[model samples]
Target chain A: MSATEEQVDHIKQAVERWNAGPVAKLLAKFPEQRAKFVTASDRQVERLYAPEAATIDRYAEKLGLPGEYPFTRGVQPTMYRGRFWTMRQYAGFATAEESNQRYRYLLEQGTTGLSVAFDLPTQIGYDSDDPMAAGEVGKVGVAIDSLADMETLLDGIPLDRISTSMTINATAAVLLAMYIAVGEKQGVPPEKLNGTIQNDILKEYIARGTYRFPPGPSLRLISDIFAYCTEKVPNFNTISISGYHIREAGSTAAQEIGFTLADAICYVDTALQAGLKVDDFAPRLAFFFAAHSDLFEEAAKFRAARRLYARIMKERFGAVNPKSLMLRFHTQTGGVTLTAQQPDNNVVRVTIQALAAVLGGTQSLHTNSKDEAMALPTEESVTVALRTQQLIAYESGVTNTVDPLAGSFYVEKLTDDLEVEAEGIIKLIDARGGMVAAIEQGFVQKQIEESAYRYGQSIDNGERVIVGVNKFTGDEPPTINLFEVPESTTQRQLDKLRGVRASRDVARVEAALAAVKQAAVGSENLMPPILAAVRAYATVGEICSTLAGVFGEFSESTN
Target chain B: MNAAVKPRILIGKPGLDGHDRGAKYVAQILRDAGFEVIYTGIRRSPEQIVDTAVQEDVAAIGLSLLSGAHLALFTRVLELLHDRGADDIVVFGGGTIPPKDIPRLKEMGVAEVFTPGTPARQIVAAIDDCLLHHSVM
Candidate 1:
């Protein structure tokens, strides 16, 4: 064995002794504790483990290096060694102007990329002045009403230089159109623009609730974007199949992988069924996951997901390109793990979680602010969150090597366990006639619900200890700075929207809307007409309302 | 204490946050602890929540939120319950509620603000106590 392997083995033995010593003794004394250790899927588990048997072989065979099928080690061959993961910081609040400043601020901070957070109105495809948008227009995220807002949001930031990620769904096409319009104004060609639109709507139905139309219409829009982006802007990732929201909503690491992959496969099936080749679009498909407090579990989950996805793409879809099989994902630290009780503790939690994401080999990461449990992270807090990642990359030795935990007995075992459990779920999802059918029947939602409930029960029963929450109670609470949207900013945005409306050719926008409606009803793709509307400076609300009229809204079925 | 009388609770999201992690986790624990849990998926308005509570006849309503709009959302739901004549249903909440807002939530007729790390059994027992005391179930 190499010296590194010898050291890994030595550490593994010590860990085994430690687990058997205290943990085993504890388990022996408390027979009831065994039940708590077991996951919802009932995997044989101890609180901690040593790398051996099932895990080591799996790691060596699967997670060896990148550019290989079943890419368990890293997605790209050189990983950060070739190019560092995109330092995409999630930003945006209130008006486009304020959000513009924040975007510029982040860019100046050496942020490799920008991720936009849209308000509820924009997320659900409503104008800032709409009745449904009252009190919510600029509360959570930036309110993008039209091409005007998009222009202001990307004001000084050159489209050619920086890749932007917008966290929008439901009205993702409308937002993407506005972005494309902005790129056109900036003298950047459609093909020159590179970014991602988080157009994952299935998760909206299952977890997030930002959906405007029902599942049928939602899938149509997603597939349309996939088909459109494939032809128009091949570099753009049309959809970022998200497990982050699902995991944040209280799923186990395994459930996150299972449900997320299920969601991705559903999208792929939709696109292929819509008449796109598997390899043509699969390479640009990206994923988003949550990095929680469980370091090894989170790392293992990533490796297992990559391996499982590669196998699925190769074996199921018969994809020939190795890139098509690679599971390139973005991760954000779990917002659910942050606590408002002892707000300061969240910083430490986010740091640890960010470390896990780095160790797990995420393509990009966004660390949650400490005050996120209370409100949208303040500018200072958000900066701290960014610095947390910067610190990990610069100061921590973790980023120096690929899959640093590769040979660890415990990590390997956990990876194997996660794979077995997640694969079992994927099989069940397949057996149930794929993810869409499973979602319609509440199978995926039901599993996530059960896992979430059990985790809550554990914390309640003292089996799982959330520091400064269930245990480690604090007496003195620290005062925190909170971010708030000014009502005046909303008014300013409304006025700017009005000015755009007054200047833009009204007849042209009407024509554009008519074209979008026609395309939506017909078998034609919506992106081109949507782009036409965007070029005509059609308002986001108007475009969405037209679609809503045709596609109708989604009313979720109850339990 | 009869085996036939399993404690039933309705865990739900009463607004547009779309985050159901806490609600789901709590529901799972209550199920393992032997309770019937009905989880209504995300974007449930205040009126819908009260209506679901009355129809399901749950002992308590566990509202979950991660979005900072809990104060506005939870209060509106409580007010809706009062309007709908279902104010008798025990209402408690769990999520990323700040310490400052806990007292406010209580004042707004929330029985408890079960913040992070509060044991699931404790929440379950609290519901049982509320149901027994109010004689609602």
Candidate 2:
């Protein structure tokens, strides 16, 4: 046999000998040999990790980092050595003024950028005073009813100084407009304002349900933003095509990457079809992914995504710009991994996942709070989470080198394996017309559901052990200090909303809304008029309702 | 379906808490043990959830809340169901519920309060028991 064949033969012989010898001989040496093996019930079999067939070098050859094309070893030659990943934390709660304080706090604490979390009404396009906003105002995130809220949220924070990332997909254009209005008020030109908007709407239909318009109209709004952002905010990232929420909604690492990239592709194809050159906007396109407890898998996913995106941008789209070829991303550690049983364990999980993101070559990262499962993170808990990132960046020697696991046999092989698997999924999506069509057909959602089901089965069967959840039993579920939103914050927000409405000219708001409605129907970009409406103090709900009347709402397939 | 059969439970989130990890985990466990589950996505209004339960014709409705507005939100949902004459949907809850509030919640006609670390099997058995005692399936 050849050397490779000889190694395979040797492994087979060893497996056969182990199966037939030792314990077998010992069993034969005793009367209970057959009984010993038979007594072992089917229960243990369910917990075993044996695949139908074992590959050569489970961690070495196929999964190796550098050996793989589209290079998952660390997307670039110098990952952290050249520049540490951006520390972006999602922060926003209660009213605009309150959230602005938190935003400044996060920045003072060494956060590289800002990621805004809009409250329910704001996300669905409603003002705080709207009946729909009644019990929901500022419950989960900050309420931004008008440009006044946006101004307070961005108060004193220089738009040109620090990049801001907003997690608003449904009402992205309006929020983007508000962001621009803040930039204008600050005397900073739109081109100088840098940041990103989580404007990926397809994922909304598939995972997060904050969508307002039907798919076609949603695409039009998204494309409108894409066209406007490239021209107005040249440095700003238009859409953070996301798979992070998809994974948070119960998906595997592979599905997260596959589905997210599929969504990104959909956005790219849409923009390209909208008469924009691939190179013009592809460079500004960004991605957001979830970092789960799977260390190797998560790391492999980043590397795989980078490599896949590079090739797709170059070969598929025929993009010539080097920046367009690189898929810059922001990763948030999975909130689902945090267990309320022993919430402290979440610190360790976030730390590990954060390290994986850094090692995998993310452009930015967000480590979720340990107590997020229970409530909004307490200041103490948020500090601890922030410290987790600081410590990794400062103390961990892992950042000293570029692609620390670069030439490792196992990591390389795993990266390659992941790339191949993800590519296959992409091809499957391509055959079915792409992400938009695939999502409509329920392909992506079904895949995530299956993986989620399998994962749950494994956890229940003890194959996947969530510490303190399924394995270690805690006596008295330790008392966790949960953060409570102050009732006064709501009153303050409502007061502010009332004051802004009282001061702003209602006629101006009407004209702005009318202009927005006209732009929604025509080929004109919506951001400028939307900003005009925001400046006129039009409620977020009013602007969104206008678009809804034009675009319509989306009701998803239950299946 | 008779009370002897496994009581079908529809656990759901009735608002914009994109935190569905707990609900999804519970759904899988309930499904494996044989319970029909109807999951309403994030940002669902209280009325939508109640409408879904009545339409799906479920026996029990388990509202999961990680957002701290459980007291207000759940009460409104319950009140809506009562107003609509669908109060028969056995109401229960889970998710980040403080221990002190459990009794208050139970007093509000919530059949059970499942805190974190309560085993999946235990939840299944509890639902079964609650359905049998209440003579509703």
Candidate 3:
């Protein structure tokens, strides 16, 4: 990319001459569609990017070779040529038996990994029969209240052969404990357990809002899992520090990177303070991002995120391991972008977002089904969603090479600009004394809320076009089959829960529960007692209630 | 309801799921439109919402839920409002609800149901209209 002074001068003069002659003449007649162009993130995009007047000097430092330091190109040198990104459809609903059927069907359809979406009751640590769980059992996802349910959930699936990712926080310890016990029953040892848990709690407080215990005990639980996983479940990923929810909450692409990494930095800082080595747990830490339809900005945002996180780990935390510096992530198409109107159009939206994720070099992907905005995607739409990824991988030529858009002048400029933008946000967060303090002071929530308001306003005033919503008109209400979670699911799950309670060793359960609370009160790693409790068939509600007594619940500090 | 005074309303989120962007945005819109708004943060129960509406003596109760439990949760709120002799409080709803259920929700005594893609001005106008025409008002 090096050029002599004469070459630069010639390029600049040629551009000026053409703009004055042809460009000026065309502008007087044809004209452009809009006065100014902007990305979905509101970044003002230039008509064209040129090296004649732009900064593209630091090639080696800023955009290194794939798999090298500051991995702005791609995390893997071979990229998809080595293997396509894991096609994981995050599916779970109804009873464990029903969800198990879905998982086996997906695996048969060639999904490489399994992602379990627990019901709201399970996510918030309520058993099926609990009063708070009324009318909500198995509504959004599969319900797992004890080791028995986890066993049924993973019934015929071989643990050692497949990687499972459970999207559970707040009660992540209890769920992971259940998962481990299930693995043991299948003759798969802890070391052979390959999977991830969305154990991130910061985003729960900031965006997702599934938090249970307060910040103190929440951080303590996360650190304990990190330490335990590094030792016993050596192949397991302990966390997926998520920005998917943050973006769903309407933050721009920049805030997605800024706030996610700030939360990550706090997690690392917390773990280190608990006496864990950075290299040990940092390698297993993962990220989750939403793939919005802003093609170039979405691609560049991923590149910028990789570079920013790498630099943060190496320079800020003094890390030496290369794996610790690499930013590995899972991408799910943005759920918020799917419009309930003209649900079929969502198929097209998911396709473009999926392409951006692939071009950005994601490690794994979950394409939101077209009908998700209305309800949980039906089986047919879920198949089409999975086929979207399959089409891009097998037909689209973009994944034939690594980081195909790496050298484009526009993408490179965006990469640099986005990195700078995110860093500025992180700096503001640090000025408020790190992420925990910022979240406690409601700074993080306020930033997201403002961005969300602006985004909503744009849609309302026709500044933003959501096809079938703001622009395209429909004369009559359209009817499409919506997936309904049968109310019988609650009754079925409650019966199973009652049976488990009637059959399990009551005395052993009490002992394990006491041990869990003792460990929670003291400074011991909580994984052991939690595993014991799960193995003894203690319900999720029982274990969580014990911890809640010690660590109290975290209520929103409303502004 | 008088032409000079905008009715007060309590916007509440009642469910396990915490998708609150819509709830917060509506609260902001109503507040800006000269209405007194109390936003019950995420994860409130129907009892809490009904109790708040009674205590605040608001003209309307706006509920939001994205967890697909809206039909049951909103029904519970309407039932509680009826039992408390506060059935005069206009109950309105919004979330990821489908059009097929809109009639059912309206028949359940929810004064209005706003789905996705609703304009801010329309929400403020609808609530104002709902309050101005109420029999108790």
Candidate 4:
């Protein structure tokens, strides 16, 4: 379906005429924003895209009907026409009790799902009372040390009624176990459980550094969860391989998809090697991506990721399940784009980013609060963020049709370019012996570092305009009151941890942790012992420390 | 004083926050600015930070945190440095610290607190001034 030379010459003549006529006149009168229009990834955006610019020579081959093979238009047959995306605002801070209150408030305010944010201690598998957890008990997100905290965190949330997404990695096994224990107490069976655990640890080694164990054990734990979830929690999304953190870590959109999919390949390869059928696990595999401010590029990124992943699942993995080929993803608005200087501007930024996610056909979305750049968003800010999504869903009328921007010349061209670029990067990663080896060799980190450095330089050099920071400078001090975690939160969490230790059957906890250690030592699935430990009220640190003793802690080699 | 003896700086993350882009950028910029910088990577405890500061024999310590635990973590680093009688090492802060906390941080013996959007050159200059003032004193 390649373009004919005659058609290419004809389109070229028309483009040259238009460029020399109206475009030149307009440029003489009013200059463009930049000399050369480029996306955040540094890809040049042509002034105009026509038939020749787009890569889809045969529409049926590149983008078939929606919900068909190579689902470039979208994953679902009726995206948003059937139902709006699940509005899941990521929120947590202070304590489980406090975070639970926030969750209830959001649910009442029309949030369709829950996305939990764990504090540093909870994320890295430390108890609230551990010396490492000292000032950070519940500052960033909710602190879930044991089943007690998990139960409190999800006290009134009906497990069967709503979907939950836990942004937990490294210690995803422990958190998922605690969640299951909580669900069991709520009278919900494992098969009825529905949620996603961000169990992708390769990104932890590459971008976000919350890893507890080495790569070998981390992949094993992930494989164990994949096996466990396929058998037990059939409806649950086992692993949300994430590019959100990678994007936040300053990777380009293509790198975000490339590195994330490369990690996905590693996970799927590991699962297959461990004897799990591709269809059994691939359907439940989900992705998490960041919706940055670039509206069209972000939308195209989503489309390209879907098309690329569909091809990978079908051609590479020999997946027969149609559901396995669909790249269902949850998107969170970019937090790094929120400016601290003019905090109010973040509302508009978040609105645009959320709209991009909607147009990109996200399965679920989390709009960041305006005040996040300053501090944890206040309730008012969070409500505004949620309302932004609602406005897009109901009032915007973009949801009336599926893949509204699918055939636009610019979008189609960008989507094709993104797919090719990302596929090229993935090929390089494959050549480097998969994502883990590449990460160990600092390939991924170096790419992200160079991109981050370039982005910063662009901002510094005035090539990239950050509205409030660079162009529209303002000196008004922020008047919004930030949500502050009280200093006593640490002490209160410590007291609660002490109380749990006193009340729990210490012998049972010890036995459960010992079993967890034994499981870590052997090739047995670590989920059962971890679940047993969580049920016995063993703390996160206790379980992780046992595994740490066996698997050993990862000391990153600094470049 | 030997001109060849570069002023070594220890860049430490003294809490559970894993956002190290700012710290890493600062480390690279400082290294380019002719300072030997040792980054303690992410999620280092305050004790570990202080120990690294001592072991590296750095003239200044730059602490970066985005997890909103700056007050407690910075206070612990300062206290530990005092405890170890290494208070001569200049301490500065970076990463998402609110403007209101900047004064308090400075009052608590932090030489400066570099917030978001701060250029690498500004940080390098601040470190240079701190080192120069420390040598004179």
Candidate 5:
């Protein structure tokens, strides 16, 4: 993608003619809108992007055809043309029954997949009745205490017909086990089940503070799930290495890409060290990312990530499987970019970011509602968010072709720059002894914090314009109904948890818990015992506590 | 606030949510504004936050909660402060709190509530103004 001598001369003559004529004339009359224009990541946008900007030696090698190695253009040869990206909305709050209703409603509304949001307690493996779960139960997402709760959560949903993505990390194994058990009850074998688990824990240590066990046992648990799922549940994505949380916590676009893949490398290395073949488990590995408002940067971020990851798997790990080289990912519109000042403006913002994700060729997508800046979105807002995706898919016509923005000079330059910049970041993290050691040494945190602080300073100094906040200010009170979880949700969940505890066989639960403890003590795959305990109706708190006894909990420096 | 005293403040995260960007930013700004700030990080209980405010002998406490559990968590923190005989410690807050809930939170002894997008200068000025009125001495 380089400029030939004739093409360079053509652009040079045309630019010189314009600059000397109309450009100078306009400059004397009126200046540009701002002194400088920058992208969301603060990269200066060139006034003119030409062929020289994209100087590729061989397009076939560097930017290969879709579905080939170095898939800079796209992962799928026929992306949304064959089938539109799966529209999965992340929704869950209150009790299992309530969340089930939401899921059914979403399915009825034509949502292709389900993404469950677990409450803080459920995420950290605390049952509803635990002391630490007092006020937080069901506040953020649905509270699933045991298999009973999971069963109710999936009440009438056809497991074989739909795919589900669970945003669970520290207790991903237990949650996945519960999901498998639910499939079993529905007469659908584990191999027939299709879904993904946010089984990534390194991102938890680096960005989100939701880790239960330390890194040693955490990676062991991850590899165990990897091996288990490969053998039993072939359709499920074993781990979704997430950059969404990292970007939400205020890392720049390149940092988000670098840190996420760094963590992925750590996981792959750990799985290899555990004596698993690269092709055996690498194909099931998926990624999750955030699509911010920067149009080309966000899109290029996805492209760069795919190319970089393809290289890593093929070159670094010697992965032979074609599926293993494809960096399949799900994307969500950036939550941090939503403004609380003019909440309705978020719809436009989300629309833009969602378009970026689609144009970048996401496998699955979630668009945030307008009201998320102030509260969990109401059903009305959720509908609007879903419709936004439908508009992009059907009405917008971007899905007519794969990688619609692939060959644009600006986009190709951005893709290359992002790849180089993110590779530099990865090299730095590798020098720090990989992601785990970097997170432990607080190097990654410090970098993110500094970026966040600078971003704040920019917004404060009006270097960046947040509509309805720094510019076009308004004080209008929000008339949109804020989605509120019932104050009694905690009590209702506690009651359900207590009833399950009372009705379940006490001795059976105890034996299952003891078996989990034994597995944790030894080098056994913790999945079987954990699944048994989950199926036996032992609470999440019980299983996590049993594991905690063997593997100590993680507490951050919290500086 | 006596300009000489450099009024101490504790910014506590009082919920299961670990979104600490706001809490951390506010703490950094307050510290830069010459207030001695103590940040008890994420997943802090009401009891832990109240005990830290009392133990640190801070003149004010700023609680940040984004999990929509602010109503329950803030009430409990205020109750604990009262129970610990530390009610004089001014407690302000911030997070994803709605405007309608601001009055309710203030009525619960929360001195002020800063929602998302509040500027650093405004937060520091408000804290300084509140500490001046609710003097530690």
Candidate 6:
């Protein structure tokens, strides 16, 4: 509802009196930190927010009740009142067996879900023993070469009980197939398995650069997964259209939502063009985002994303299912914001980010370890990170009520402003023939590059303060012992790969790969053949290379 | 300050690590600092890095790795330079290298190793110092 002129005048008078009296007295004793207060995205924060500051014309239309159209408040009707946000800590490193131990440890520590982190070699579709995988066998995350590794990775973990999320792209199909096979081995049907794979490959081209194939083939593979999972694994999220990497690569909150939804638009359009019903597959679609340091802005970003996505699905695509309209998402704390100097300061930084995620209504969250800026976090550090979420869920009173910050004038204004700005960017992308074509023209990459460069310059010039990093100088050697993968890990992985190759049926492996190549050349879904190959114990490198021979590899045109 | 003889540097990312924000930022800052910079985009092998260094005839090589493969990748690039008779090129490394590994990286013929929180000016000054010392020798 619009404010009356008399009410506006009264608010103005009160603000003026407050500013002239107490504000002036305080300013005389101490000065403001900066002349202008801005958000992480450079949006100016007003001196005071009031009824006039809100941009909504009618509350019912824009800010409807929870679980209704344009779900701005939250997705679920009783968010956090029914249960707290899922505390899913992303942990994986070293061999599959070792990572499996970590997963069990987290589960025993009250982790609600499992999020797997694959090593670089596995992420880019290389086998552990490949020459390209040397010195990187298990450096960043767990190494999974075939069904044996996948089996070992999930040895004791109950597949039907625990929902797992794999942070894998480019090779998502292969890993998904391996996951399905492992479920079958555990006497669980594909329909009972539930999880999310970071199948958003366009972001890889724009932000992460872990892409293996060109855009055309990559989109085809994703389309195939959407079709396959719709029938085979109905409970699983087919694609987690991710903004986490984009934000980590240094995008503003609006850009994170803007580019992410743009990519989602491209995927939805691609699936629709492939003759799939929108309601059939869109229900399982989920999102992943980054929760940075800005409290209100981050919360507003999630709200804006939900509202914007609901409108897009309803108006743009004519999706009838209410499930298709709700923008469910998982959030991870921003790793780039952590500092190597004064590493303990990262604990405070992570607390702020995790709280932002929880307050923003994230469905699941992964809080980063404080020692991550130096290396892979140790077990002690990871446990502390997990306990940070525990403290918020059990101890903090923020989760007691739903949308606790709902009526704040500043948050509401920020939400409206960000929605409009992000819609403007999405319109520009739609004008250029959607995100894939835009990425092909290097437009998205250039935008992120400019943003990252500007942020770096801000730190370089002292315009932005990173606390202990650029200010509050300190001199202390790191006291925490980093978790280091033994150099023998590579040798051990190679030995296991050899053992698998010697034992697996050679004819079955060859036939499965041949089928994969043929499907790559044809219009058939590649998941079945890929699953067959994975079940036959063909290495990831073999299947990927076969398809690469048909679909070819991608090399980015230097910007 | 002559334009014709600006010290050329090759900024390359070795291995499958795709985090190129630091590499690209350093490239731009080096270019802004009046040096010719050529960037080999992500996922360049060690041979490709050294080959590009020789082919471009760059005065120095700036290698960035965030995948914990800095020791192996950096040493391979240095060994390749030595093998190809391009040992005069000043080599430096950056990106998430642990503090303890910095001394070992320096001992392996890397002119310097810049960790996180390093200013671009400090890196540019290090490159300048390396070129000055090389020219004097």
DockQ of 3: 0.69
> For model 3, how many clashes?
0
- Candidate 4 C-alpha error for residue A259, in Å: 0.3
- Candidate with best lDDT: 3
The superposed Cα distance between candidate 3 and the true structure at residue A74, in angstroms, equals: 1.1
Strongest candidate by DockQ: 6
State fnat for each of the candidate structures. 0.49, 0.33, 0.53, 0.53, 0.53, 0.59
Candidate 3 chain A lowest-lDDT run of ten: A48-57
Global lDDT scores for all candidate models: 0.82, 0.78, 0.91, 0.90, 0.90, 0.90
lDDT of 5 at B86: 86
Docking outcome class, model 4: medium
Runs with alpha carbons beyond 4 Å of true place in candidate 6: A1-31, A53-57, B1-5
lDDT of 2 by residue, A1-559 (tens): 4555566577667766775777567656675522321100011111112221123433333233442334445545666777788888898888887788898888888898898988877887777877666666787789988888888889999898999999998899889888888898999999999999888888887877677788877887788887887787899998898888888777766677777787878888888888999898887888898887666667767877888887788788898877787778899998777887878889999999898888787889899998887778887788889889899999998888766765444554556666777788888999999887888898877777666666666666665678998898678856877777777766788898889889999999999999999988987878888889988889898999898888887765553
| TM-score of predicted chain B versus true chain B for each candidate | 0.90, 0.91, 0.94, 0.96, 0.94, 0.97
Clashing pairs in 4: none
Q: Give the winner by DockQ: 4 or 5.
A: 5
How many clashes in each candidate?
12, 9, 0, 0, 1, 0
Off by over 4 Å in 4: A1-9, A20-33, A53-56, B1-6
Model 5 misplaced stretches (Cα beyond 4 Å)? A1-6, A9-29, A53-56, B1-4
Q: Write the per-residue lDDT of candidate 2 for residues B41-113, one digit (tens) a residue.
A: 5556788888888888888888887666677678878888899898778888898776667888888888998
**Which regions in candidate 3 have their CA more than 4 angstroms from the true location?**
A1-21, A52-56, B1-4, B135-137
Error of 2 at A529 (Å): 1.2
lDDT tens per residue, model 4, A1-559: 3455468678879999999999999999999877888998889988888764334456777899789988888888998999999999888988788999999999999999999999988888889888888788888898888899899999999999999999898899999999899999999998898889999899999888889899999899999999999999999899999999999989999999999999999999999999999999999999999999999999999999999999999999999999999999999999889888788889999989999999999999999988887688899999999999999999999999999998787888889899999999999999999988999999999999889888977887788999878788877777778878877787778888888999999899999999998998899988999999999999999999999999989867774
